[model samples]
Target chain A: MYYRALGFQKDYAWASHDDIPFSPPKIPLSQATVALVTTAVVDASIPKPVREANSYPIVDVPDHFDTSELSWDKETTHTKDRESYFPINDLRARELRQEFKALAPRFHFVPTEYSQRHTIETDAPLITRHCLEDAVDLAILIPL
Target chain B: MTARTLEAAGIATVVIGSALDILRTAGTPRVIFNDLPLGNPVGKPFDRDMQHRTVSAAFELLFSAEAPGAVKTLPHQWSTQDAWRENFMAVRAEDAATLEALGRATQATRLENKAKGLFRR
Candidate 1:
């Protein structure tokens, strides 16, 4: 099912095709500071996007919703219609912190945001400013 | 700031993205290969072993990459996503509430879209 979606019919050689770019030099993982932020609509302050302009943002359970296995919930059924706000839900945050602890001990968790492919310069400086405060040397973003 | 801005500021950034097509079209420079899934690139949540492999592979590509357009895809038995659905069956009711809430919020949705229009950060 997954293979069909990526349209991977070009050439199996792509797997062996090792060609990438360089910027954050391949220094020892420690020498380089790292951060991880996922696009799961997770936010520490507000509820995971379950309200609408005319709705009360009710907190209800969805048909297939699950919450006990981990610290946060990635799938939310309360959202009005998959809004434009960053879906920084509790579940995503939990998973993010887990990855941070695993991959990069010093990895910082920057505030969540929407579409990494689109965030504006002025809008992100505020978030980046705090990341700088946290002593973050670099960022490792995972878009969900 | 974009990779260009970060480089200009002397703060180096490594964009481990799956959108190679978009990156190529836009002519984004100094990027690396990481065909990890869109959100969970390093494989499914809690899969530590795979995560390590993905991160290690990314570093290799980053270090050995020849030129700006240099690219590399990991040789591990990579597969498409969708396994998460079965795992998600164990989610709790409270967590379900959270997902529901996040799915609906209208104002927040608008705000997110607005941010997208501003920058592809």
Candidate 2:
């Protein structure tokens, strides 16, 4: 769909796998440390038209994300409400209720890279290291 | 793609997305497929009830998914009419030339950024 919409000469070859990686929760949900990963970049300092993969502190999650530059269904919906994408406040309330152990100290941001190799080799490993360092047991991936 | 990689690296993941075809082909481990627009996957803006429901559903899938590649579609509707699907990302004839130029410029900037190794630190 994007290939035709973007007027690419050929179809974008999407990555596929028969053996998908699976890892069951080692601890119960109430005892798991969960983190948030989003395709939306949090830093407004990073100029438009240049998408980069990075991470931000969960403590400073913005009230709204500037998404005018990214591609999405803009006509139907907007990212005016940050919780609609980030949901840090809701997760914090859930944490108070003991729905999970705690929210991770930081959330991760990954760019929607066209190259699957770069995603798998570069971005994925960096995020994996961050998750491990933070001792996160689960991650909720929200792509915008 | 990062979701699967995270799962492989021993951290469980649940993807909340609206693109079923892309999510399925990508082979995400556990998916909470929301049949809404691309950007607002969790729920509509300022709809706290719907947002909470979506997050609760994600947690349910995270706890209940037994195998890899498991997907559960959330029962949420964008609107009563299905017109949005047709116009979801459709480029209007009037905006075609402008959008094409923007796409080219964005790609050029992306390539230049990559060449200069300008990843956020």
Candidate 3:
């Protein structure tokens, strides 16, 4: 309900942390490898939890993973119905591919649920090693 | 996950988010981005230029040491706005119903009734 009231479900959703596709003029790119760390549910061991029955963010589920799921319309809010909520606004990342690949084409993107698991095994440091394994010089950590 | 730990790994990390102050207040203990929302940390899903701009903007934080715990909010990207399940709400409900029906066939609910009668004493 709050998400709808705040317009996040529809439009603001797409405005999440993602890799865009535009090529910048020139930013004097860094030689360091760039990595993306997110809170996306990725443990094959545990099945993804079911969405809360009444928790907000349900209204934004996309209709489909493909194009029928989105609308460029600006008048009314474009609510997603669940085509791929796991993306967490990753559609922006897909669209902005050129932008990210430009900075570091070999960038490594990894998702970890450390915030939820912060008290558990503490996977953050291990995740860091995975990024560094690829010689990650800079890492973009996006938390949910 | 990646932000604070990578920094702990001695790799400079720049964090971005619409809930920067919220995160810091909650004791995130590292850099903060006082910009984008929970879902849209970098920028909206489609605006490449803004997304690129947002991503690069965070990288700029590395050059600043004026504050060990720093935060920055970038230019707001507002597009003539408007628009928004749980992933398993309906499915779980269905699964529960299926199991309940099967139990009734096996008399699980009936078993509860018999137990209640036995304990009525």
Candidate 4:
């Protein structure tokens, strides 16, 4: 409704808020350990999140991941022998070149269709702990 | 989901995706809006060089951003037209009823999976 008031159509997802948390990075880019997080349902092996209530993880590189369930055209996703929606190879190449100090021990996968409540309460803490455990300093979120 | 939480826990993040409005509303600490296809956020599939640049630019935000919720627009061009509109139209042109049904079914599947404890290891 708020988005519609701003001339956006009914299809737009709009949320009104007053205050949210904000914290700047404490380290430089070259010294940081980067991690990849995506919501494109990387592999069918990943347990799907609950409707508006949860998130899950896909361990290791999904060599056989499928990307057809997402809204994107399959032609683009399947081109050039691509499998997973997460860019593991690209991130790895950057890491190998020392673009960053290191790569996180593991990557993460979270389904995009969920409520803010679930994200803030469950998904957030899980990801934070994982990042902290792996000593990751930066996270790259690739939403579908 | 994870972006804000990571930032709050002292880790920085850069959301590289097409939905600038959604990311801002979600309070993403750092955002790099890439006007690319939905599934191809990093770059066009198999284009390693472009993908590396996209990831590099995303990481650059860690130091360049002055405040929380800093959003920068990337200059890469992955799609020729409006990405979301294109996806929506692509599905609609196929079958309107099927698209609507599939949307509902996806939500239902989530609830089903949640009940099965599939959201955890």
**Each model's lDDT:** 0.39, 0.85, 0.42, 0.64
* Ranking of predictions according to lDDT: 2, 4, 3, 1
Top candidate by lDDT = 2
Residue-wise C-alpha lDDT for candidate 1, range A1-144, written one tens digit per residue:
222222323322111112332354435444554444333332333333221011111122122221222222244212132211112232234336553222223222222233332333442453355445544455544333
lDDT of 2 by residue, A1-144 (tens): 445545566778888877899998899999999999988867768764355667788888877777776668887788888888888889999999998999999999887777787788888899989999999999999988
Instruction: Point out where model 2 deviates above 4 Å.
Output: A47-51, B91-121
By TM-score, how accurate is candidate 2? 0.90
When candidate 2 is compared with the true two-chain complex, its DockQ is: 0.59
lDDT of 2 by residue, B1-121 (tens): 9998899899999999988888889989999888998888899878899899999999888889999999999889988988889887677877677667766776787789877876443
lDDT of 2 at A24: 89
Q: Which stretches of candidate 4 lie over 4 Å from their true place?
A: A1-20, A42-59, A73-85, B79-121
Best-to-worst ranking by DockQ = 2, 4, 1, 3
The candidate maximizing DockQ is 2
Q: How far is candidate 4 from the true structure (C-alpha RMSD, Å)?
A: 5.3
TM-score of 3: 0.48
Per-model TM-score on C-alpha atoms: 0.45, 0.90, 0.48, 0.75
Best by TM-score: 2
Native-to-model Cα distance after best TM-score fit, residue B76 in candidate 1, in Å:
4.2
Q: After superposition, how far is residue B96 of candidate 3 from its true place, in Å?
A: 24
Candidate 1 positional error at B92, Å: 34
lDDT tens string, model 1, B1-121? 2433333343445455555665555344444444443334444344455556556555455456555555555443334554534443344545665544543563466578656562222
